[model samples]
Target: ILRETETDVLVSYLPVGAEEATKWYVEQALTAGCAFVNCIPVFIGREPYWRKRFAQAGLPIIGDDIKSQVGATIVHRMLARLFQERGVRLERTSQLNVGGNMDFYNMLERERLESKKISKTNAVTSMLDHELDPSDIHVGPSDYVPWLSDRKFCHIRMEGRTFGDVPLNLELKLEVWDSPNSAGVVIDAIRCCKLAMDRGLSGALIAPSAYFMKAPPVQYKDDKAHRMVEKFIADLMRMDPDTARKVLNNEITAEQAVQIFERLDPETARGVIKAGIFNVEGLTPIRGAAKVAREFGVDYGKFTEEENTYLRGLMFLFYAWTRQNTPNWFRYITRNPGGFLAKFLAPWFAVVLWNNTIDEELEQSLPPWKRDQLHLITGYKDEDGKDIIIYFRGAPFVDALE
Candidate 1:
């Protein structure tokens, strides 16, 4: 509606899990000739088709998701990095996230949760070098507690080796204000998108996305991502000399330039930089196809092999990284069948696996016909000290339970 009244840019602050609606809005923005800044977990900004569309139309766009300034993901990622750098043999890890928001409410549906899980899981998993089985690592939003409002709590646990055979563990709990936690970062993202418009940059902004999002088109270390945002901000200042000078002289607010640029046409926006009408700011000139895409308004470059390699490498690393840290015996059982069978043959393995100390307790209770009819039960001690019985649907014998 605003675009019909001559709005030039559309900055969407959609919540998570609104994948289809977010795409619909992006299409609406394109039809309106308004540039898009997608601040959500939907895949549009990172996907090739939409990126190509925006680039072709010469419309600026930034992001698939916004990262909180000092949120749990970064904190956990930093700790994981510390463990890896300090040579800890990280065996297993999990993050249980709880939040109260419409976003959190929406996520309870489960069906719309795939990308959210992927984004959060990959954020932590990308940092590791070793492979981990998918089962060993548990990283997902665990629950929604309504009383918390926008407050979210995250519990992160890691288990690994210290030096010799010494065991080490890490546990951290983070409580934060969710929507407000991300607002400041979105401010920077808006600036970055506007600057990208002015400079004519497009498709897969490596630095800005890495710094300000949980899932970027590519992954980089936190420090590198920070450096990239700083560089982008500096470049934006240089692209507008009059605004730069005004801000330097304290004659105009930086917010004023932001508002003005938000209204400029894509061509006029690009002209401001090409005419050298603005002072060149930023730590380095924007390089890579992101710059080309912005300038030409079309991402001619295809996704590279390096990205695929990184994705596979990160997934492999995560699968190997967290396996040993979990308690399930299935992971080990599949790996060493010979040793496992030997252990199972010994009486010790049976006792240890089943916790059956009494010899009589190990005896079969059901006859063949009764066993086949599912008339099988397990015995245990209740508080009353009498034999406690639990029935099973399938005829699982004592030996089979082992």
Candidate 2:
């Protein structure tokens, strides 16, 4: 839909566990011709192939992780930054996060937990303009408790602080609902992506990623990043007279306008059609030849029953001419009228051509004995639908004429 919807940008706030599915989403966006902003920890925005694809599509993209307004990643990053900036040697830090949501349930699959760890770990570590060893930091989702519902609670601890080589400690606890906590940030991302598309800018967007995500390609302070977005939006609004008018009236959907432009591209339109992601009218139907071919693997022009009739005829004749042990041909003939005519044309020792069909006049013109034999073979009723029957010498002919 990113394409045909003429979307300037698409912001994906997919569930946490949807890594592979997110790749598929990116493919759809690229194929459909829309800017993509990934707001999940699926690693696509960070991965080179996805980055290259976005560049090739000429669409702006940002993100691999979304941050809540006051969530764990931001708070953890702040504490980590405070320690480094204050000249206090950091000893240890840990953020234990617990949440109840489908995102949490999916993360229970530890095999899918790698990117999440990388995201949470890097969010804090990246804050220090200097390097920190692996043993010093502890991050990632620790547990899922069903009773909590959508509420998420996080405990952040950093054991370091102050001058004079003094021993200091910090412990913080936070709690909030998971989905709503991130919705505001997601909304901001959506608008930023739209703004990028409006300017015909493509590839990864740095500003929003730095401000709004836990793990952007780069990092920036929350307040600084927020100011940059506000200024960019203001400038973009000024350039578009129509958007400016909307802004004046307080009637603009900053993100939606971008999507409208994206959908107008032909390639994106076709992707929307193929994915059935968008519902439009008067496209091709999934019926008749198309349906049969796709579902049954049977091509209409190749090996249809009528097309293979001659081969069918040969099979029938092979049984009959050799007088092989076979079931009654008449029984078979009665069951399949089309197959009967198909078989009767089989080439063998005899070949007959007749212009007239077995009508009343033709039947009456035959000799009486021949008529009687034909009648008996056809149960005293003409096989070809003539109602004529003949009694011969006061005895019914029961033997096969062949």
RMSD of 2: 25.3
Q: For residues 282-345, could you state the per-residue lDDT of candidate 2 as single tens digits?
A: 2221111122223322221244443223222222222222132122334433443222221232
Model 1 ranges off by over 4 Å: 240-402
Candidate 2 Cα errors over 4 Å, as ranges: 1-8, 240-402
lDDT of each: 0.60, 0.59
lDDT of 2: 0.59
> Cα RMSD to native, each candidate?
30.0, 25.3
TM-score of 1: 0.59
- Predicted candidate 1 versus true structure: per-residue lDDT over 1-402, tens digit per residue: 966588766777776687778888988888887767677778777788987888777666777677788888888789888988999978899999899888788778888778877887788888888866788688877888999999999899999898896999989999999988988988877777767666555554557778888778778889888887786686456446445444333434444445444434545556544543333332111111112223332111232433222222212212221232232233333332232222232232111122213223332422112334422222233345433222222222222222
